[model samples]
Target: MIKKTIAFKLTSGFVVIVLIAMLTIGLFFIQMFRQYTFNSKEQVLLERARSISELISENQQSSGQMQRYGGLMKALGTLAEAKVWLTDDKGNPAVISGMGMGRGMGLGNTFSSEPLPAEAQKVITNVLSGQESISRNFSSVYNEATLTVGVPIRESDQKVIGAVLLHAPVTGITETLDKATNMLAISLLAALMLATGLGIFYSLLFTRPLKAMNRTAIEMTRGNYATRTGIKSEDELGQLGSSLDQLASKLGFTIDQLFQEKGKISDIIASISEGIVAFDLELVPLSVNGALSEIMNQPQLYSNEALKKDFEDLGIYGLLEGIIKDKKSLQIFKDWKGKKLKFTLSPIIDNQNEVTGSVALVQDISESERLEQLRRDFVANVSHEFRTPLTVIKGSLEALMDGTIDQAQDVERYHQRMLSETKSLERLVGDLLELSRLQSGKISIHKEEIHLPSLLSDVIKSLQTLADKKEIEIVYQGLSDAPALIADYDRLRQLFVIFLDNAVKYSPSSTVITVEATLIKGNTFEVKIQDQGYGIPGEELPYVWDRFYKSDKSRQSKGTGLGLAIAKHLVQLHKGQVSLTSELGKGTAVMVHLPWILGN
Candidate 1:
């Protein structure tokens, strides 16, 4: 029932008011008509009675003829359209005239001089006592309601004698009143119906705009702010609808701008390679991205407390806390999960320049840290390599200058040692320069399709004398029908020479060094140089390609520890990969893989 709207309620109330007004007016009119009808009947009855009384009085003065008066009374009753009754001084009836008794022509004796009814008796008594009376009373003679009027009968001497009365039925007045009441009832019904129809029409006209606004409000709640009310009128409801439409349009535009700004912020955060986290003044976590999860080593560190604890455990919270307290930026390096991480924390300031929150950005610096350490090690290694040969040359020269070697044989030995040291120094300087040139991309390759078998044979023959000095044999395998490689001829030959020399340098006496060349999957060619020598430790295998790194430092006298490193760079310059596998007391194998179909 409450769902019934204002329009329905208003219309129903209007109909009720119309009905009540119609009923009230109908009742008032009916009452007034009834009264008027009664008054008119009484006036007619009184007029007829006055005429009868005058006629009877005239007859009494002219002659002592009661019978003649009764005859005249009957004629007056007929003219008045009423029943007439005449009585003597003793209250005895003399004449009665009306329908059923007599046709107003003669007296009817059958109307037995009956005593009048109590109401009429009272009226006659008052008349005899010299008072005129008019009353509505029931008549026994006529058997209906009648208006009774009695006047005193007097002689010329002004002495009261008998009274004459008249009786008139009031049924006509009641019938007339009833007819008027029915017509009023019908007219009232028509008016009420008309009023109901008009009430409904006005109610709908007024409430249509309100209904549209209600629907628009509901749609706005569902986030469709573009909806509008189409009501176009000059009333208050129309103005309100226009206001609602404006509100929806404004809200839609504002919310759209907010969403676009939010999208841009999210995109910027997602695009960065570092871990970013924002916190409120209370250090509560607001948002975290995928990079932050990886940096912290905790994929579920979305909450502020969890992230804070993680950073604290990694020994980085003190830096963050200092930034928050001091409202300044801070940078710190921390170790987390065996990886070096650099964190930059800065305070976020509001428009008033007051610190409202803070943001932290984390980046992995492990690779960069390792590179810095390598730089330090490279300086030390270079100094050591150059100093060893320079110290030998300087000490030998001092001995000669101080005349410490006086014998001829000792002098020749010292001279050869100096030349050997000079050669070692020259080779070291040359290797360092070559490695630098390769790493800096200053050296370019001249590509040509050369047969692998011919290249390996030339490299082996060039280093055959060195292998023979150690009593180790150099053998080549899988060289028959070998695929041709696209590479710079001088660099490719140098690449093979370095590996074969290393195998010969490290191998035991009477052990065979095998250089295997073959084609592998993915259209790639591989060369494995296996040496039956003291194998490298597993931990040292990963660093073999690093500059100045050597598996057997005790053999530093043979060559600078840059041969394999140089080889690794040269292979990479040819778009190839080099890997080493070794075990203690077993043989070590170095494999180089080069794409067989280069620039195809």
Candidate 2:
């Protein structure tokens, strides 16, 4: 089936909403009407109950027959299809009356249908016992609901001998409710049908120009300034047509100039390799060239913010403020990720002295900063790395010269101390060598598939003695016998061993160590070595992979701090990634994602 258009659907929806509202209101009205009707019936029965009480009071037999009055039963039964009984206290009904012949009518010795409700019996018993009056509304088992009214007939001694009850039927009101419901259902359906037809007719009348304007507007949006609606009605449609024609006439010349200027500016921007971003008077980003985005190394910057927000945070959000307040052109340039930027701010005044927003140009100076940092980090790491061993060597040499090693034991201790310093110096040199080889691709690779279960078992066994000495628990977990990617077996062993060794050294003697591996998505298996050791701080996480970088927490301990740095490089060589997550005192989890395959 073809779907209805928006205008037609709107009309149908409006009518539906109104119809539903009317039906809801009608239901409430019907409920109130029933309440009023039932209440009127209850009052009529109560009057009959009182009248029968008075009539019996006026003519009570000495044997307490409660002889039927002239019209007492007739008046009570005339209200609706109901049965009134003057029953004795034993429930043996007597002096009964009814009106309007009904189907399956059975009221002589007892009611043919179910017994009376508990509430109606209670009302009747209370009236008889207290020689008072009572009335109640309840659903009778005979048919629909009713109001049962009771009154006691008292003797001359003012004592009740028997009771008179009036049951007023209320089925007629419920019947009326069914009728209104049917009427409402039919009326609502009719309203829906009428609304649907009117909607189709009106939709065509209302949307004729809107459809025409849409076509014309689309063409104009595509830079076809000659496109016009050519409609000239006397209403707002005519006004719109005139406006569009005038816009098309003047916009032709304006658009030509705009194209010429825009083309020239685009050429100039594409000519250079620098990134440039321009903003309008309201600090909205008007233009961004390719060069500046290239400097950020991320393309989502444009996708992230609308044109108005990009310039809002220029120069870390202060450049615009500075220019606007000072009323003078301001310039700021900084290097980020080795890219240099030249930001300029000038006023786009309309013959009035007012300052507009700024423009920024970013150029790549990565090669210059790259060389500069290489020199700086080289000097820094080398100076710090050499100082510790050199200090120990100077201390041991000075002690020997002071006659502290005159005896054989002292002389041998002095020599051993010096030898230890030389070894410490050698380890630093070896790290420097390994790092150089890894970076320059000078290290040869022995690429082969390796099983992780055996490798991890060997690492744990190698550390068994250390674990026993420290009273630590070691755990290795993984069930899959997955084969790993091309890598040197020895290098991979060293990588895992560093983690275990570190956990053994830094963690409390009784802490647990865990090694786990599992296959992830896309042929990638992750191996995580976890430890409950002293955790690295959040601030130091960003620089954990840099050379010679150490957390202040672990700085006073031994071992080449280059352990993590070396691990990072080796993982990168296999075209894999290593990530470290830690929270202070909680512990650390180092994850390694490597491509692997089932040995099959």
Candidate 3:
């Protein structure tokens, strides 16, 4: 197999074209030169033939003396080396030259008295009709390649009376044409050889830069971006090379920028808390980041291949299908791994306003959902708490106005009931105000070192009456001279009172509500409140610190629902940590760790 380069192919094509052109022009010139030689011979014969016919027509007054031109014809034929004949207007040959008749080379064997042959007759007829005729191929009457010409003879009155026919062999013309053809062949060969050499040189000149550009293209395919075709010619090829260089440069820069932007987008997708994914219309995953994997509960799915499978497994395909069909965005919330995740599916629209794909954005909204629910519950609880007190006060006032209790004892009972309800309403309002200030960071604390033993003793003593009302014991267990803790004294007292009151209210009669304070790890003090009561379920324990939350709402306790919430917020405001652990059908424990800061 021959390997063909651009130079080889171009040169080969140019040579073939040159050969064809030279052959055509050479054929044309050779034919023209041959015809030119034949025509020159025919002209001389025709001129001598005309002179002989004119002499005969002048010498004789009629056809009776037509033989007088035979001598003249012989002389003219000898000089022109051709056969001459004289024919009357009726195409009858009357005289023939002795030059070729005796040699058996005339129009026929009967010479002067014979009829002209068909082809020569046509020439004679044309000549008699006042026209000249010449033919290059008149071989039938001659033994050699020949030219034949016929000219008319006119009388003194300008009327045609006879015709002269000339028949000449073209052998000398053939010899001359052969010599001229050989010379043309030699010139054509030399021209072809020169053209071939020039074709090769010019083909290389044109293809050299193209070859360089081709090599540069190969280099670019192999990732060598800096290669360039340094051709500087002002031709079209040079302009093409310049365009290619600019294209390569632009492509390299654009590709680098795309890689950088891709990295940045990947990092952003990975770092964000939301799960982000993009897919084409075919449901094939275009991109799937780590967050999306985590959201799908398939954290191992980090590649597009696995993510596509995950999408089907997680039923996200249906969501995407819906989004595409509707050409609109959709949002849904689901519980995933104990988190409330809100997923938004939006259609990816192209410039033509067609939905080409979709993107999913998943966010963890459990905290927000819980807060929103808590706000609703707080509003309802506030309304309920207010209604209870107001209802009792309105009943008592209506009883007094209708004179339904006119006796002194009945009147006093109604008055006391109204006053009790008003006090409860005032307590609820006060608790709400205090809780709001503590949670909103509007309340400030004045910190001082307070002995834990003394603080606990005072709290137990203050809540002992309430504990007794339920027949529950408030037991304190701690060192009498334990280390002091840095905290607001009044807030700390209030915190303990809320805890002790709750313990006493929730515990069974005759059960123990134990309070213990101890120093855990130096510079940190802990307080534990434990009670033997119907404990909260594990599922509801997480929300027990939320405002207006109650584990046993069925119990008709008179205290407001803000105790534990207020306690938790007040603890946090003092830079303390609070946690509670409980088990159903068992007991509950609350632990508070406050930093032990020494102060004035």
Candidate 4:
């Protein structure tokens, strides 16, 4: 800004000085010429007066002497365009004539400006007294300027008889001077105009490059170092442009390095399955990545919002507003898109220890939360599963130690209780083994055709007693002659039985627990188990197929939490899919798909 101001000042000053100098020189010459014109006019009048005096003397002693003299005076006055007057020594007029001849043609007629100023009058009077011609200039009543010359009419003895004075209005001579001055003014004005134009043109040439350099500097602040003043002049402006280009080049490289570093850090962060959010002091988004956008369930949430106005339109503006007002940040536990995320918001502080803005780190803790809950559930399930068996085994072993039973019939009760405990332990171990096998590819399923409708009916019959006790009705519908699926029959059975048993266990007495088997499009079989029971909540649907996850409301039941997990795993092992759709208090429809190859 300062440089621009200075440049403008210099340009204006240069123009002003050139104009002033030219105008001064112009006026100086014009005035000088005006004076020179007056002097030239004086010399011409004196020479004309001298010629008239000699003409009058040469024509003396003629018959028309006075007439000849009058004609000579009248002609001279006509040629000079002046009023001429002749007088005797005592100031009486002798011969008088003037231009514009005719009406006032007498010696008494005064058509002239006589009576000059003291200085010019004294010079004319002195010459006339010496019987010689003299010239002088003065102001006139005919517009304040008149030139006059007086010549004496002398005898042979050199005695003055009369004086001949040639008088003319100096305005005609002033006109020539005026014309010269006007010409000079025009020249001076032209010079000034040309100088101003040149100054403007050169200033533009100089300023254009500087403006581009300024733009480049401004762009650098926006992290755009690639901006340049693309000019190549031979002047100082060119040198400045070259310097600016060099600066831009160095800064561009630095910016590129910074970007690469930032990008590397960003890539590392985005590669994680967690979301990271950064904001500026204005509580607006500064940076966000793929994970954050995914977490937010919107691709546009993290894009291009760099001010508080951004949040105003978001409706969740209160969150940022509250944080800024409180000068604090906190981790918010959220369930986003059926996924658990631990969001930690931390304030970014300057060196002054003042919080400017906040940054959020979002972690997809769906798996972590699942694992934590798994650990808790495992501890509970293991304790419950072992407690019943351990109680029976303890009672039987105490009785045996006390010698309560000796014969086969008496000792058999203790042996059966020990066997039951041992079998329960075996079931627990077997479930673990199954899960490990599914995860590690240790157990490969042998695929075969299985009648799902028939198999499911048999399992229902076996669990009919348990369903009856819970007042749950097992209703098998849509069990048409569906195409038998080519899958691991044992694994399919496990998947079906788990869902069916859960439906029956949770339903009220006489409430229908529907078992549906039908052939879907494209040779696919959908086995749906729906229960008019207390349904799993929406929040638990994602976790239902996960390991060791049991709904809070269902924890009263005596069963391993691994049942659903194992079932889901087993179904997946057959290249099938299992999904649960339910709303709170509404019946759940657990759909398991078994694909059938076209030939099969």
| Local distance difference test scores for all models | 0.80, 0.70, 0.80, 0.72
Per-residue lDDT over 1-600 for candidate 2, one digit per residue giving the tens place of the 0 to 100 score: 234566766676767777788788878888888879877877767676777767666666432333333245566566533556564554444455643322211123332333544555766677768544545454646455666767776667777656777665676765788898898888778877787777767776666777777888888889888888867787887788778878887888898999999899898996688766666666666777766556666654454274334434444346665666676666666655546655565544445666555565655666656657856976876787688778888998898899776888888887888899799889988998898888888887787778777787888899878887888888988845765555677888888887788777777778898989887885886888888988888978976776776665435666767778788888887778999999899788899987765543
lDDT per residue as tens, model 4, 289-347? 67767765664546654323433443335675667667787766666578876767677
Clashing residue pairs, backbone N/CA/C < 3 A, model 2: 275-291, 275-292
For candidate 4, give the lDDT of residue 378.
73
lDDT of 1: 0.80
State the local distance difference test value for candidate 2: 0.70
Q: How many backbone overlaps does candidate 4 show?
A: 4
* RMSD to truth, every model: 11.7, 35.8, 5.7, 13.9
TM-score list, all predictions:
0.58, 0.45, 0.75, 0.48
- The candidate 1 region of ten consecutive residues with least summed lDDT is 102-111
- lDDT order of candidates, best first? 3, 1, 4, 2
- Of candidates 2 and 1, the better by lDDT: 1
Tell me the deviation in Å of residue 232 in model 2.
Answer: 44
- Candidate 3: clashing pairs of residues: none
Q: For residues 475-516, what per-residue lDDT tens digits would candidate 1 score against the true structure?
A: 889958755678898998999888888888777888898899
lDDT (Cα, 0-100) at 567 in candidate 3: 96
Model 1 alpha-carbon drift over 4 Å, by segment: 1-268, 298-309, 315-322, 396-418, 553-555, 598-600
Per-residue error for 508 in candidate 1, Å, reads 3.0
Best of the candidates, TM-score: 3
Ranking 1 against 4 by TM-score, winner:
1
Misplaced by over 4 Å in model 2 are 1-275, 279-286, 289-359, 362-378, 597-600
